[model samples]
Target: MNGLGYEKMEKYYLTNLNDLLLCMKKAINFINPEIEYHHQQVAYLSYKIGIQMGMLEEELKDLLIAAMLHDVGSIAFGEELEILNEGDRANAHAYAAYKLLEKFNQFAYVASIIKYHHLPWNHGSGRSFDNERVMDQSHIINLADKVVVRLNRNKPIINQVNRIKHYVSNNKGSLFADRVVDAFMEISEKESLWLYLAYYPDSINDIMEYILRDNRLTVDDVVSLTDIFARIIDFRSPFTAMHSAGVAAAAVEIARHAGFSSNECKMMKIAGNLHDLGKLKTPKEILEKNSSLSEEEYNIMKEHSFYTYMALKDVSGFEEITKWAAFHHEKMNGNGYPFHLKAEMLPIGARVMAVADIFTAITEDRPYRKGMAKNDALKVIIDKTNDGDISKYISTILIKYFDEVVSMREKAADKAIKTYKSFTEQMKISQEDVFAMVAEKSES
Candidate 1:
């Protein structure tokens, strides 16, 4: 890595512990502005409860950090299910949240909270390995999160307050920790806390700064945020979990062997991760289908690249990066969909993305088919070279490094499912909590 590349990576992921927290803060703000530093409320409530129960400052900060990332999975859920009815929304949000956080070992505990945020505490009673720390904070975040959701949506104030009270009462030992309920009950009695916690103006940047100050996030934090965003694209479909990562790995390796500048290769990595953001709009069934697709379904699949390009086309700092991500589908002869970008219009980085995309697809196992072996996969690419689709020169370099590229395809395929076992245990919270919270709010 060049000095500049090293600097960017350090700023985001490899950093001092203080820097990581700061990054998390900024990421939360960018990804969920509507919540408007609502993570701070979760942090505040979690800290206060931790303190009331005599936990140390360091422990409280850990809880606070976890709270900031609590709803991060929601970003992974994308735009479609985010608009679903209340019950589906809860499940979608919590599942998406868990899948996103579980990638980093540092935040696995926090991921547990996001997973179980909607579950009742007692749901795991039969399991000997049930985690106690996660149970407590999950309840705390769920309660705090509900208050924010209701208030922001302009739900009746008195009703929201009573709902909080009743939710705690109904699932004391089952969905919530007994002590957590005690603390929430005390806090619910103070009406002003809810008002202060929920209030926010229209500006997203304002909320971003608020979260940064409270959590100490910094610009370097965007690295984690970027990874989170990349994961979001894959999470929209089970077939795509490692899609970006594989594309990135393959593109970077091919770039190196092909003698591209280090800067160009770095850009390639970012492009590979973002190339499929448009796939978030495609229905999961269409993307995962094994049999021949209907023309209608095939037509929907083609729109994903267009959606990706449009979404990032206006985002600053993504000028060059967006091309590689969105142009991968374009053919050298100008027969591609979306923009139908021609060969001369396509940049070297985009060409690399196209190569990486094709190589990864053939080598990785699909829902209906086992992975094509490396030699067989290479033969397919070579045939494309003969057809004048993929360039002969770049195809040669890619096939030369086929061993490395196939390894990436293997690694990525393994992680494509977006499955989190721990979260399944936590999903139970939402079933009971939603029913209880709604009924309680109705009665009050």
Candidate 2:
């Protein structure tokens, strides 16, 4: 592509960071139904405190992003999400969030902030631990997190304002930084701020626009952000650690072979990466089940694609991507679920995604069995195609280039696994440790 062509393509995929963040907020909230909009409320409170503290526009944007994503690590907590919420300390989730964010160099600072978001500010003495000054942003997020956690949405702001203030005031120098506490105090005094938090939760993004008015993301930026969530989704279970990445690679190649434009192929890869965003809602036990799913368990599994659609459908620039990603489970015969659109309704991109999902699933190792041989995998897919459960044309294309496509999928999965291992290594934590902790906590 020429310079102008590249620029146009970039613009075609260009999206607001806020749009992506909004989708992510939905995905994270889907993990635990009880904590809807928890991230957004924290982001709003953090942004308000930042403004009250006279932070620069750029600083506020960073704080907002950091606050919104601070709990991303909690995805690893599985059923322990409620336990993590009830406890008040930095734990594995904090380290996991740090590791996840720090991979993207632009988010390194934000990663640091999230790492210590739960840390208490012991007056000025808390600023330096081991001769390092904790980022003030961490303290800001800490205070915001504390406030949002205790907020009672059912009560009127007027009734709760004084009580909330007194509570925060009591922990002024112990649980929170004095300056951050002061900023919260100043902002909380505004009835509008309290009302915004209590009533206009959806307006948090609108408020963010005032701080990030000109923010725009390139296709590459969106891909990077999606890759982060992809890890969060796949990393939830050892059985599917590299699942999304493998599917993305396979789908991109399938799109290319199907004569899609370069831009379409790129978008296909993104859709593949995010196709399982809703899988975050599935409990770890269901994902790792060795036996066939019970009817109830099967029904729960079927809801993932719907959740994926709910998360991505409203993202402004992700219209095609959302359809392709969310429709992966639909069959060509109109017998498939969440939506049962038949052969005429299923787009080519969605068809390719369905094939990619099946191909990757069977070809990749799972906890219960080894990855199938190439011929065996192809046979299963071809049988599905013959049964009218998948796209026959796409299955034929995959069969013809089976070796090349499989190579692409394996290479992509290898890279994702390597990247995952790097993060776990650096954090000095492993999936085994996290699972063990959850198991131990459950037994206790």
Candidate 3:
């Protein structure tokens, strides 16, 4: 406890909040890899526009976060992807993005910007919505998003500049704010902005680093954000409502029993929460299916752990965390879908994570089948442990204090279910305002 205990640890999760946002986007891009990515380009365009508008440094910071995640709420399997390509017009995703992101104080202004990113100016009438002030930065995201969508990625970017500029100019004071358009028009004159945008994700990191040099996050903040990640990953289906939360709880207690320090236990929780982040790539139909998957569907499912690795591998402080999360499916006998590391290669932390994952999963009820009772579930764990797959030592620890571990796991599942209900409630809020706005224009 003396080494990395809570009191002595100051910067265990110390990270530029900017880095976390990019890592989140990596999980999201898995929604559809074949499509052209726009979040980074939109962030870069919005950054340039924010500077041209002379916004405060703090404003630019939130603006960048908002721009990168403007379309985050639309992350679903199939139809949602098409909706984005066709343009949302603040009708659905923008407000939904707000509902999901507003949970974190770190995304305070960022939530607001994403909520109104698709709101039209309506000839300057867009300054406020629902009697609350709309941040001007939202309009910058709106304009940037539109510009990126209008670009034909198949052609060289320079050739498409004029057409994109014309759309912005044509929508001035209607679809876009005057100030934002004026900024875009000025920047559009420089051909370099378009070229850089074509290939600027690495540079976006540099920009975010500069803007966030003074604003590092605490461990608690990072943990709260991971809770958000779990919600995003599991919210797609009711059967998985609290799967990640349960795993995190089971992992924390199991790691503690295995003599991991408090801070190390916290890292286990992060690993558990993010272990299923790749499931976002799994189709919704597959996720919600009430029957066993065919081999083809199972093959698709196997890819998620691999993608989970790819998404989290690059995040700062997640090197060990990534393996712990991604290796939950790996076997000590060298039989995993994505990576086949043998017993010698598997770390103790990764071993704890795998057992935690199995324990929580077998105990939790899903729509398709009833969860196993204590004896039944423990038997499953024991069989796997004896087969030289999962860690026998961790399995023994889990069974030693099974009741207390079950209590903690149930409490975590209960908390996560509440969050899922809250999100569904938030998701139900009507998206009629944009429709009404459209109707008004036709009448006039």
Best by TM-score: 3
Error of 1 at 336 (Å): 1.8
> Compared with the true structure, what per-residue lDDT tens digits does model 2 show for residues 1-444?
112243354255457777777787788777774444777788888888888899987787789888878888877544554423634224466778887878766687888888777666766665854466778888898788777777888877778878878888988887788899988887777888888887776677777666656667767777777888889888877788899999999999988888877767778888999999999988778888989999999999999999999999888778778989999999999999888989898888899999999999988878679899977897899789989999989999999999889999999999988877776575555444444433433111
User: Of the pair 1 and 3, which is ahead by lDDT?
Assistant: 3
Model 1's TM-score against the true structure: 0.63
Residue 109, candidate 3: alpha-carbon lDDT = 84
TM values, all candidates? 0.63, 0.87, 0.90
Residue 144 C-alpha lDDT in model 3 = 86
Name model 3 segments beyond 4 Å from true. 1-7, 11-13, 34-36, 76-89, 156-159, 198-203, 441-444
Each prediction's whole-model lDDT (CA): 0.62, 0.80, 0.79
Please provide, for model 1 over 1-444, each residue's C-alpha lDDT reduced to its tens digit, 9 standing for 90 to 100. 233353345334322334334433443344445443666666555655665666655555556666666666565554454521245456557656766766655567767766666554454441222344454566666555554555543654655777657765886666556777787677667666566554532232343334334443223333344566666666555566567777878887887777766656666776777788677667668877878899999998898888778765654455777788889888787778778777899877788888899988877766567778877887899888777677666788887777877776566555544342234345456445455544433222
In model 3, the clashing pairs are: none
Runs in model 2 deviating more than 4 A are: 1-12, 81-89, 128-133, 154-163, 421-444
| Residue 257 Cα positional deviation in candidate 2, in Å, after optimal superposition | 2.6
Off by over 4 Å in 1: 1-99, 102-140, 148-205, 213-238, 261-266, 311-316, 373-383, 386-388, 415-444
Sort by lDDT, top down from the best: 2, 3, 1
